[model samples]
Target: MIKNSYIPIPVKVDKIRFETEDKLIKTFDLVFMDKEEEKAFRYYPGQFAELSILGKGESPIGIASSPTESGFLRFTVMKVGVVTTALHNFDEGAIMGVRGPLGNWYPIEEMKGKNVVIVGGGFAFTTLRSLLIYMLDKKNRKNYGEITCIYGARTPGLLCYRDELKEWEKRKDMSLYQCIDWKFGAEGPIEEAAVEGWEPINLKEPSKTKIKKDIKKFTAFVPQLVSAVKPGAKDSYAIVCGPPIMIKFTIPVLTELGFPPERIINSLENRMKCGIGKCGRCNIGPKYVCKDGPVFSLKELEKLPKEY
Candidate 1:
């Protein structure tokens, strides 16, 4: 009974939580303004929606909250463009437009019963957070193998979902390795100082928090954490999302650890005008990122042209 794919439904920003210290990245909690529409909006964990602010523009943003957390949807936006800036400026209770659950999701069926390795950095961590949460839910955890996550940011302050990450760290069901590229006065990640074994990764000045052991003091590149963890690739799928440099290095390591191309998944993004397949900007070879992807297993990706 839902109508057109291009028509956006009006929603109200339920709340806004700044995920980072600089406030560049924010998590907006959203709910449909219409109760009927809200009850009907259903999206998978790795899917995305076209978020619009009318004159500003409509942009494709991934759904950050898992379906397991059902009452509302969440989108984490980094202020990088006119549309995103508009989203960040909106106050709680502000009305906005959304059109989606568009784009293919992470192959949850393929991931079932398999170990999962989630790797991400910067703002690209959004969808990965969704996938992780869905997999870790009590009803779903038994359906999967061991879950490991390697997440990083440039500095201590830039990591997303720290509160959830902290709670995830406390759970015995999953393993979380959090690191940073560097802190103050470092040329590069401290792990660069040694070719083998993990360095202390300590901060120059200790954290003021009196928890006896603080999470922020840890320092290393995202790849370095992957190297140290060296997750078993025999029955595992590695889902990686990050900037070009990080993805370039991380893939080789995952391969070296024994994961085949088929078992590695990559989330791709391209310039999107219309979230539906109508507009050609999101096209890559024969596929449209907004429709066919945003999530692709490496085997599926290898068959496509390299232009993307």
Candidate 2:
């Protein structure tokens, strides 16, 4: 829905929130400079846009806000490089530029009436948050069946949207599974395992006990958590976004749970650049991650060159 692929639309950073205790990740809430651009710049979960700053270059970031949230766009960024660090230094009301709503989205329509499993790790949870919020919206909730979300980070402090994660855990419509790295497990000191409102489960136990309905926190890698959750594959689809290693391992767990390749989805945002297909940086075989994807089913990715 972008009016021009080459030009970045003017926007203002209305608010900025640091997402992690390390202060390396920040979520920018942007408001389009013009009301018309605000309305015209429609986007969905899993799509990304290029954020621009004069002389600093552009960075393609996933849209973290759901469409159900109007009048603004949210991008959760990690301050890893020049552009992102500049963004982190910026304060509220800082004017900037945005260049999309580009790339395909999660199979929202196809997911209608099917149980949805969302798996994510670390900072990759941004767009997954978008998809979850969109599906959980009242208007869209009826179209989807049960929703299950399994998310993990190295520590509780590294998790994004901490407040929202707590709220989601209380929601009856969806099941929320949170995990920290194994170092935070019961084997660790009692003080470390006692994160407020979290209960650690011993990984040596059966998968059933590891994922009991009342137990939401686990000390394991994202893939191990997915296997423990063991969500049903009947009329279900699993959407996963994470580090490459997490995806590599999680795919097998989903397949073992009976989810076909087509039913296992992923987002390749780490490979995205330019936000339009003109730049070849995102190419994997004949497909452009910025154009053809950033979103793809395992079946589709299997056909690609695996360069990603």
Candidate 3:
């Protein structure tokens, strides 16, 4: 609903919490500075905001929390660049600048009655988390068929939202699968035995309690992950987010599993300046990655040049 490009609304930080042990990922719970701003602002799943750290400059980050919870907004930021690193240093109750919750959202209506398959790798899972929660909201839950989530990271400790993932796994309406490319050897037998039902046969649990971080070795097992999330021959959709290489291989696997091009959704990563359509940095051919999408159907993706 935030349609204008120039409006700069001041939002006070309600909380800045670390959701992951890795210093890279943090969640900021924010509310509008003037209570009225909250009344006017709303966004759909997969839309994004332009967050400015005052003098440090602005960056576009996805609205990582679902729109179902209305009082506050959240952004799950990974500390990758200068502005983000500075953002990591901020504490609770700080003020930051926020602009449009811009761009077209995922086609939730179109997805009704269709099984949802979500595949996320590394930090890319942040935006996918928003879509997952949106679908899980009470009214929306029944609109879709079975929900399947396939999430992976470089290592066990590197995985974000461990507690949330555990809870999601318990839901009767959803099937959740998580994998770490390498083991850190921290959990040992207990953790190993627990995940056997979800992992592939060739990648069995190790006898030792400690594990190593080896993402390269895990690349071979990606096909198996794809298999676990593949829907039946009909009535399903797949949404994927992750590093470029993971996405590159996963799409082919989904196509082989018979998911049509129009049913496959993906969020692209590119250098974005404006959260709205104004910035040119994130353009892939004629499309603006920020406004036209962070989310795109496979049919639309096929039309774009492979510059992203």
Candidate 4:
């Protein structure tokens, strides 16, 4: 019986980056305090850790960088509660605590030789970012077939990793498709609809506010853009991470294009009071999400209770 499971290893927050305009989600780059511990760290994408902030308790957040990324571990967090809010408020160099690389990761090995399509929205793009980086690395890029990424946010300001997305768009190895919910004002779909007299024409953009031209090009829902990509399902895998509703709608789109349940994966997260899965409440059936998964194939997930 290991008695020290509750103790957290000390780490120093080396850098802080605010990826979204609202500043609700921030990515913290951390390194272990002990050099040896840093050297020994290992994790895969879609795994998570229990992050501690002393008085604020701890929360489970996904590890956002590929193991190929060295030196530091990165966690992209949203300030949704006490611990996360405290995390966002913490400064660079602040000492913190991390428990593990808990939960399963994406099936990288199984995905080899298969074309891949990644679908993500808002901050849920963290692990997808890791998967993309790993697959796109020059050493590994050849193992896969065609690569396509379809990502979106409510608006340009809501997108994470903006600069990286720009660079990704320019990369010849993978196809990048980024979209906004709706363009706003005169040049937007809403205005286009309004001028056409609002008689049930589809809006290309979701909001009524104006935005820049660079953002206007992606003025479509993620599902819509995904359909437009038409990635073949026969020899491909689709990994999706997004809001529950976004996920619900996106699955059907993938299926419509021939992707099967076994080839579609979801990186899931739940309210975890204990990272070790000892509390038992994160159960979707016999499985404890914290310990058994944070990643599951659509087929595997279907076998579990829909209560999730």
Candidate 5:
């Protein structure tokens, strides 16, 4: 067991809303009840928070909203188990406990003036969203080179932030590509209703659609995607977050595209009992994942055990 020393702060949930059709995932917008606490709160991209629902227990969740937006903080959560399911039902005006804006942040400062490529899948994209917004903010936009995002999901309906993706698509300065694994027509009624307003309707019928079982196909697409975004080597960065399999194949493709090991950033997911280092559950060797990093360069991660 780990020792606990930090005091839990009371935060008022200003709003709670569904981000996906999956009843499991939800977004919470919160503010510290005490104005002083709000003033003191600060965090960088890729950090996480320890949230507790009184008797229900606590879980580590990434701070999904960007720091560029002040006055409040936000978290995107997916209900994978008991505690998360209980948290999903929480709503506006509810009171929850919070412990930290913990963990290492992405090397945003080091990435300045470099082209950025972000690849994400499923809910893991939550933290990546913050990094994307931080780079796109009006004042910071010029500090980074061209931005490209490639996001995928098990299916179209499972994708989060429908409205936000649309906004990203309209930005001329950035490039965004979204893909789904299964063919849409395979679903009966849901497919018909869901496609009513969605764009780039490229998903083929079940019979014609090519199921992407080959890992090589994914690796092959990475360079093509990055080439379309930033054609030259020069200064560039790549950030990837998603299921383990995606990371396994994507890294090689990035290296082939000329991004050095140090230029690639990744976030490791684990059973984080406490968002801060106080909990030993997320320790990776001598480093506490919740403290030293959830985000790290490939070079830094090479030293960790394969357990994560």
Candidate 6:
């Protein structure tokens, strides 16, 4: 673990895997240069880190690999700006910096014995993947009740961790519901309702209407897919991570299904930067997204300013 929040620990890129077909998003696996740092680096799911590149700046990304998976840490990054683009250009074995294991984590202890409903969309599924893998481990599996996941992307190619998603689908221990915004056929992309800008007339009920038939893939927006699956809210906690629009729409569906405000949790990764409270970039009212949380119960968030 890092003793000083400002000093970044040295690490080397062990592996890189492209997640999206656009060649923009990639997952980097890193290992600490010092064996002691590796031993000291203790973290739980939902915490984030600042990946630093000398002379290029740093980017805050959530820790995608769970603690159960040892030896390395994983971060899925989209090459959007200067720092990310530079990191993407570097080859394997390149050295970098990781400044954290910072911020609060998902309520792992609180979630024990309760059913878990994970709802994620687009690239925001990184930390959720960590939480899921942590819970699915043999030692942790019996500690939680039923596990259900609802994940969707704009298209099949946009989804991250495709191979693990496939393996997740095959597991009898949990239920996975995957969807894509539109299904492509010889004609082209089908289903306008699944598109990002399209809003349903009724937020609680997603429109099932489609522009075309004979599309093979499950086609629906993340919120719409949540409504269709309709996981029971009794004795359960709902964790949501996605674009702001998706989270805005999903909360109502989960609430309509009987999840109380406190039972609904959200991860505000977009609000984070610097991975520490010093920057003040991640503050909403008196609380800091970097320090107070990247994870918060819906009830907790409601108590804060509406800035988020």
Poorly placed runs, candidate 3 (over 4 Å): 1-4, 185-200, 203-223
Candidate 5 TM-score, true structure as reference: 0.84
Give the alpha carbon lDDT tens digit for every residue of 1-308 in model 1: 67788788998899999999888999999988888897778788678999989888898889999999977889999999999998999999999999987888887888899999999988899999999999988899998999988888877678898898779889888888776766455565554342222234323312221212323224566765676667899789999998878888888879888999999999989989788898888887899998889888888888999877
Native RMSD of candidate 3 (Å): 5.9
Cα-based TM-score, every candidate: 0.89, 0.93, 0.86, 0.89, 0.84, 0.90
Clashing pairs in 1: none
| Model 6, runs deviating above 4 Å | 1-3, 185-189, 192-217, 270-273
Q: What order do you get sorting by TM-score, best first?
A: 2, 6, 1, 4, 3, 5
* Superposed Cα RMSD, model 4: 5.1
Summarize candidate 6's per-residue lDDT along 82-149 as a digit string, tens digits.
99999999899999999888889999999999999999999899999999999999999999999999
For candidate 4, what is the lDDT?
0.81
Q: Which residue runs does candidate 2 get wrong by more than 4 Å?
A: 1-3, 182-210, 270-272
Q: Model 5, which residues run further than 4 Å from truth?
A: 1-5, 185-233
Worst 10 residues of 1 by lDDT: 205-214
Worst lDDT run of 10 residues, candidate 4, spans 193-202
Task: Please write out the lDDT profile of model 2 over residues 32-88, one tens digit for every residue.
Answer: 999998888888888989999978988989999999999889999999788898899
lDDT of 4 by residue, 1-308 (tens): 57376778899999999988878889899988998776656787778889988888989888888888887888999889889988988999999998887888998899999999999988999889999988988888999999989898866778888899889978877888777764433354333332221121234423233433233235566776676556678899999999998899889989888889999999887788787889988889998889888898999998999877
What digit string (tens of lDDT, one per residue) describes model 5 on residues 174-291?
8777655444546432232233233222123222323232211111123233332333345878898888977886787677667888988999877887666676887777777888
Tens-digit lDDT track for model 3 on 1-308? 77457656899888887766667788888889887788777888888888887788887888888889888888988888878888888888888888877777888999999888888888778778889999999988999998988788756556677788878867788877676654445443223232323342333422121223221122213444665434563788888888888888788878988989999899886787876666578899999988889899999999999888
Model 4 scores a TM of 0.89
Ranking 4 against 6 by lDDT, winner:
6
